[model samples]
Target: MATHLITGAGSGIGAIVAERLAERGDELWLLARSAKRAAELRERFPAAHTLVGDLADPGKLSWAFGHQSLPVELDSLVHVAGVVELGPVGETPVKVWQETLAVNVVAPAELTRLLLPQLRLARGHVVFVNSGAGLTAHAEWGSYAASKFGVRALADALRAEEHAAGVRVTSVYPGRTATPMQRKVHQQEGVAYDPERWIAPESVATAILTAIDLPRDAEITEITVRPGR
Candidate 1:
């Protein structure tokens, strides 16, 4: 069975992905920011491993990716950990902007950097769970959009860098998903954004699994899933 490493595995799309992987009998390493959530998932999937570390911290993420004594190497790396900082551009705080980039951009790039060796060993796949915001711009979403744009750019570069080495990178850009991040975006903006009625986490998870399970010779660079409604 393939061994998959998923960040932001504590909830929503991440949680759904983890569940589907486990159901498929794949070995899993679920990374999250909360010990409680990790522990709960561990209990739910006894065979899966859990690590609670803040991706925003390079040192912490580094340790979780490599320093931990593991009997198995990861065959797939899915970066689902990201933040959405929404506010009018002029009112958005510098710290919040930095934090959003830290998780959405820096963490994925660094984690991919560290895990590439392992992925190369297994001829594995890398998945980036980015946002449509990464592809399109909007008002009051400058920081979040910038970070996701960085994510899109990073995935593009990594795919090129590792293509010859048999490591494939796929970026999944979903629009207005019903995840906590979307709820927060709407709450902070004080608006009614009901795009969630169409963009389900399970559908995105299915698409990601399909991408990862594709033949090594088939490289699906990027896919955009928008809410039907």
Candidate 2:
């Protein structure tokens, strides 16, 4: 069974993906901000290694990973932890912009760097759960869009640098999904939250699983999932 590490594994797309992987009998290492949720996941998936901490804090992440007796190799590293702070460029707060980039971009990059040795050992896959915002910017989404764009760049750079090492890097650009984060976005936009109008997290999770299940020799560089009209 493949050993997988997933950040933001407590909720939304991350939670669904972790559950699916656990069901498939893959060994799971889950990182989330909630200790309670971690405990619940540990109870549900007895073999899972759960860590409660903030992904944006490199020190905490280092401590969590270091304190654990994890395997030397990992089959996949799925980066699903992210935050959104929506506002037009002129009106956005500097603090919000900083936090957005710190969590959505820098944290993932640092975590991946720390895990590169393990990923190389297994010739594993790195999946970034990016958003359609990463592909195209929209009004009032300046901070979020910019950060996701950085994620796209990060994935592209990693793919180019690691292909020779057999470490496949994929960036998944999923359109607005029916997630709590999407609901919050809708609230900010003063629009009704309609599940049917958005992509389902499960669909995105399925796509990620497909990427992970591809032949070791094949790499799906990018995947864009949009809601049907």
Candidate 3:
């Protein structure tokens, strides 16, 4: 079975993706923020492996991973974890911007750098679960949008650089999925959340699966998923 490493696998789209991969009998390495979270994930996916490292502090990830055992080679590395804080640019604080970028962009970039050797060894794929905000920023989406845009740029550059090495990179930008993150966004906007109104997290998970499961002869560089409703 192919081996995959994934972050943000604790809930929503990430959880669904992890479940699907497990069902397919693929080897999974799930990244958790701490020992407690890792234990929780192991309980969630009994057969999967767990790695503990906090995405909130990207600077310490390398140090953290040095103390853990990583997969020797990964068929795919999927980044799905992210944090968001909403406020007008004039009202947004530096800490919010710093934390948002740290988790959403910097940590993913750092993880990719640290795992490049393993990814290269497997001629693997890297998938970034980006957001529609990465393409267009709204009134209170400044920091989160900036981070997603940075991640999109990172994916593009990595794809170009890794082409000769047989590594594939894809960015899946999903619009308003029915995830906990979406619910939180609605709360931040002071709006009621109706899970039925948005795209289901499973749909987004399917899109992610499609990218990674495609035949190696061709690659899906980027895909955008919108609500059917």
Candidate 4:
């Protein structure tokens, strides 16, 4: 069975992807921010493993992982965890940008670095669940958009650097997915949240799966998922 280490498995698209992979009997290593969250995720995915590391402090992930046991070889490392804070550039504080970048970009980069040997050994895939904001910035989305954009760049450069090692990288840009993060985005935007008005988490999860499950000879470099409606 393919083994995957996934972040953001507690909810939304990450949760769905973990469930689908588990249903197929794939081995899972889910990343949790703390012991409490690891316990909760263990309850949720009874057969999966959990890793404790705080994404809020990317600088410490190396030290944290040093104390934990990581997979010897991994078929995939999925970066689905992200944080967003909506505000105009003039009003957005330094902390907001720092938090957004920490969770969305820096942490993923560090995590990938930590797992590169395993990923290379298995010829694995790296999936980044970026938002459409990564491609285009909109008003009131400065901080979040900037982080996504940074993540997009991270994906691109990693793909180029790791291609010789057979480590495939893909960035999935999902548009306004109906997730808890989307709800928070709506709250920040001062608007109503209608789940039916947005893309389903399952669709984005499917996109991620497709990229990872593709034939070894090919690579799906990027995918943009828009609302079906």
**Model 3 spans > 4 angstroms off:** none
lDDT of 1 by residue, 62-97 (tens): 766454644246679999878877788999898998
Model 4: pairs clashing at backbone N, Cα or C within 3 Å:
none
TM-score of each: 0.93, 0.94, 0.99, 0.99
Residue clash pairs of candidate 3: none
Tens-digit lDDT track for model 3 on 137-167?
A: 9988999999999999999999999999999
Model 1 scores worst on lDDT over the 10 consecutive residues at 64-73
Ranking of predictions according to lDDT: 4, 3, 2, 1
In model 1, which residue pairs have backbone atoms overlapping below 3 Å?
none
Please report, as a residue range, the 10-residue window in candidate 4 with the lowest summed lDDT. 92-101
Worst 10 residues of 2 by lDDT: 51-60
TM-score of 1: 0.93
Model 3 TM-score is: 0.99
Stretches off by above 4 angstroms in model 1 are 63-67, 193-196
Give the top-scoring candidate (lDDT): 4
For TM-score, candidate 1 versus 4, the one ahead is: 4
Predicted candidate 2 versus true structure: per-residue lDDT over 1-229, tens digit per residue: 9999998776789989999998989999987666787888788678899766676665566777776666579999999989887778999988998889988998899889988999999999999999999999999999999999999999999999998889999999999898889888988898889988889899999999999999976889899999985
Comparison by lDDT, 1 against 2, better one: 2
Candidate 1's error at 215, in angstroms? 1.2
